[model samples]
Target: MTKLTGAEIASHNSKESCWVVVHGKCYDVTEFLPEHPGGQKIILKYAGKDATKEFEPIHPSDTLDKYLPAEKHLGPVDMGTVAAEDEGVADEAEVARLERVSRMPPLSQCYNLLDFEDIARQTMRKTAWAYYSSGADDEITMRENHAAFHRLWFRPRVLVDVERVALDTTMLGSRTSVPFYITATALGKLGHPEGEVVLTRAAAAEGVIQMIPTLASCSFDEIVDARRGDQVQWLQLYVNKDREVTRKIVAHAEARGCKALWITVDAPQLGRREKDMRSKYDEQAAQVQDSDDNVDRSQGAARAISSFIDPSLSWKDVPWFRSITRMPIVLKGVQCAEDALKAAEYGVDAILLSNHGGRQLDFAKPAIEVLSEVMAALRERSLDDKMEVYIDGGVRRGTDIIKALCLGARGVGIGRPFLYAMSTYGEDGVRRAIQLLKDELEMNMRLIGANTVADLNPSMLDLRSLGLHTSIPRDHLADQAYDRLVPPGLKAKL
Candidate 1:
């Protein structure tokens, strides 16, 4: 008994027997929950039961599909009762009907209707498809990303008048129509030739924030131009050990009106994506340029990413970056409270809570699960409101966004969902995806009796609603490097 992990003990009792079959695999989550300080309830929520309804609210939030295994573990938790509380959700049959109506084949449907894997299979070449779909090692983390969202069950409060709701919110002191933003991701061109240009422009048109990867398909100027109207542009950078390139990238973004600089630290080294290795994605990527004449220029993506990446950055380069630009500095790949505390001291304006689309590490905790731990740390250090925290990675639906906001996120980000929209249609497809999320968010807002984004608080949540546990550590945590970020004198106060 002492040897059993909370998740493992929970999994042993599941219908799948000896395995919590999520997205089709037997993961030993049993030993994992005790490591998860969030407590055992989270893992128990999905243990020995299917988590389909619990998963619906958090579908698109980047937790990875940890719930598919719950399909085998789903244990008669009465999900219909929970979903019935949401005002905006059409009849279950209606969602099915809408999804069915959305499958009118390619050109007829806008981009947002397709499922995550469907868009990848349809838009990207075989190799790109594999790269986008593949996860590290055995893909447990990839599959778990989705399943983790399933564990975060929604506890709706009915009978409150939520007729007119407010989705308006602010991030980094800037007002936003929705708490959602276009998260930074690598190699946009791989999905469609229209690439970053088509995608960011589509985001800008939607009155949202447009963020670009440092290794963008097009130059900073080109992407900014794509967002010409009122779109907000943010840039993502990887601080390679090389200092010079990092300075240049930061400077280049500020010169182009790029509002924020997001430094991604998760991929200090890349994750082992087995799918891309076997798919020979490089060879398949070459085929796009070979067939460039047939590509869609309106979408604005080049045929290859080889043309853009300038990988040379380091942690030492962060301070030097602040010296060169006034744009808000945001660290994008922070997973723990230690890093969040360090980010505050470093004079970081924000911390992007993420697991890199489950792209960098496998078997790591899901982004949604990590949100509270990071926020708790931020509050402990009194930087909760001083610095913003934006999360991304397994979010697929509007309720997922609402749940994150209630959990203390300044806002949320979506990568795969937008990419899916682009592949399914184009600008129009991407637009539909954003609007659907907005409608869902607002609808849920009204039904839940919440009037504004400010109405979201930890109080709206209940601990008994779930059973969470994981393989996270209770000790041996690292010291936060806050001293490293601030001016020398400020260190004394911390």
Candidate 2:
């Protein structure tokens, strides 16, 4: 219950006794510095100052309370006497960024999901953009996620009554307005201040489900509280190393009325996203000692927050998860048909065919491609109807959603596009993005002579070229968002 002046906290700013202000409270993090997953440098930079702005985007509000011992909670600080940190002059890069923001095209101009990415790349901060946009090394899978869709040409039917097309569909026993839901992506505050709650509100407006991430900037209750009446939300969980912690999280989510539990199975360890690593290298490398072997300096933001994920998670744990919560269990990262079969045998409610948005493994087949193989394998075993199947990654257009549905997907999940939309224009941006997809879905369904989601079939697609990995035309909008890797020596020149 102690209330200390800013100067008192400022005096203990050295490595021997460091203190930082976050959300008007003072925390003595000196002892915890060496164990920081982000490396010690970032904390040292804000050693004696207010780190609220830098802290809010990447960390949940309960982070300090959960990780730090109660003794480290040094109580509130007197903000009236706090020394105002100097606002340094903006560099040329910042000036250019501001100019781009000023010139950002109107939201009405964002005709499709790609348009949001184009604007986000030009306007977002360098670090934020890097974290959100970067995929695994070489980013081949990331590009291929969208490219694979182009290979499957649509077989539009003619002379059929297609008026009054219906886009309504049910996912995990819940009826939704559209066949696609806003999928989970971490660090929502990195793009927008309100974080996951922004997406929650947007999803409610669109009558679609929102999957809240395990590493969201906002607390779990904050996002759950943001839901409107009967607005369903699912939890995307990264199982923690501590089973007790994971169990508690599951119980709390179920108590809060979460409709499903999406257990992410792909990321045992964070993938090496070069673009994101490069963005943090300069800031982190100089702060740590070569003798200090514990800190991993190269992982950037992804590594910092994901240290607790249980790499030992396996099929054996399925029964344990079932015991914890009755919310429908979904294996979120099954890449191959074999794993898909295994998931079905385990009696999971669903399997989300994804490669973690191509962020986990480079060269991993796109989710759309995997969906075809899995659906075939499931049908062969008479297990296709046993559980719902969903796919995410590179789902941008309404046609993309149609393609997945035609191939036996109950629904599709779209992640990055919504984040990009929210990043550029807040909740309104997210609403517009969903509305655009709805428009495209209706028009495409009508064009393909499909009156309802049930009308979509594999027969409506030309599958001969779906498996071919041939050269395709360049994707200009995607290319614009991609940051080409630069050699270390050339980094300074840029």
Candidate 3:
């Protein structure tokens, strides 16, 4: 392959001859313009220039190979000949913000999950941070997800032999170093250059499962390919309105050896995430060009690509999902006991009692609060152990995992913390966070006098304070951050 000159590449800027550089490689994406999922304008915006910055957050690493032919790959560009493109007018506010972030305490100083979040907030581009942290209107449920665990007081037992503690567990039959798996969070590249691949590598190294998000900037295969051969993985799906696309996605994941399929059903429509809306995220979507086919675009970037998710997904669709693949099909967003029962009746392998991290609906009960009801409902039907139950959202510590297990949860899922860790220090941050959790689990287990995960049960917790009307102390730090991000007009309400 001949080395392409940046000067030569610069000449092909028009729609008729569009070319762009990604990671120093020049590619002729002219033919792919019309077929781009986000639309053609995004490509044209950086036509004949380096698009790596704009491209990394929303597309997979192998995106070019999947969308374009080998001949379109025009080889590496000569850096010396490349003209320095204007970065457009820089915003003074953004410049000052980046400077402030650059001076924050070193990544090594980040000592806990919350510290990672604090660093991430200081370091991440404001828009990306807002999207990752925002929940539905008022964010009551979001706060409750964390607060619920606080409400449960531990009734630790004494006189139990605690010579050595084991944090190893299993999720969907795969062994894991801890009782939690890295849950899915979308648009990871918004925080780090490597996106979900960073999570994949960290999870593999930590001996835990990483649930690949359907809306990930990196494609599903890129995440799967990043896995160590013996590492287990799961897939999180937002069913596309196009059933054929859904079928194909499911089939491909099964073929890739995914152990489970977590079908997200909470987002019939995206909730009104005010922080994201305040960011004018739609403006970013507008920059992408083609409108999403099945959803309303007025919402924001969060909804732009999500327009294709099938709102009509229902019990009837469960059978269809079962017919398509052999992997266990677990509903990812069940929020109440009744729905949890319905999920079991439908024969799903498991039900993840979640509220989409409080992103889908405002004030929806936290998954932990719903776990007791779900367990009781299952017991009534002699299905208590028939279907596995898991929870996610606001899981920041091992004690939180122990609480959920006491309520009969098979395991818990964690999403935002790992993301914040990766956003701050890449894979090392992720590994450190996992090790921190393991350390906490060991210490907590020893203090709680539980010999193993099996020893954790309902008697070990006092749930009287778990009432919805009960007052839980404010997470002052989280509240301060939330207050800072709330649009000025909405500040009065908070």
Candidate with best lDDT: 2
Distance from true location, Cα of 18 in model 1, Å? 58
* Residue 427 in model 1: lDDT: 80
Top TM-score model: 2
| lDDT (10s digit) by residue, model 3, range 1-494 | 67788879889998899999998899999988776655667677788888877778767777788668999998998877777766687687678667756566655565568777877776788778888999988998898889888888999999989998887777788887788999999999888888999999999998989899998988898899999978989999999888988899899999999999999989887788888767745345554433443334345558655756778888889999999999998999998888988888899999999988888888898888899888988888899878999999999888899899888888899999998898878999999888888888888999999878888899999988887566656799998677454211101111
Choose 1 or 2, whichever is better by lDDT: 2
Q: Candidate 3, TM-score vs. the true structure? A: 0.86
Candidate 2 lDDT by residue in tens digits, 48-102:
8888877888888988998899999998988987887776798899998887787
The per-candidate count of clashes, in order, stands at 59, 0, 1
Task: List the candidate numbers ranked by lDDT, top first.
Answer: 2, 3, 1
Model 2 scores worst on lDDT over the 10 consecutive residues at: 485-494
Candidate 1: tens digits of C-alpha lDDT, residues 116-145: 335445434555566556677777756566
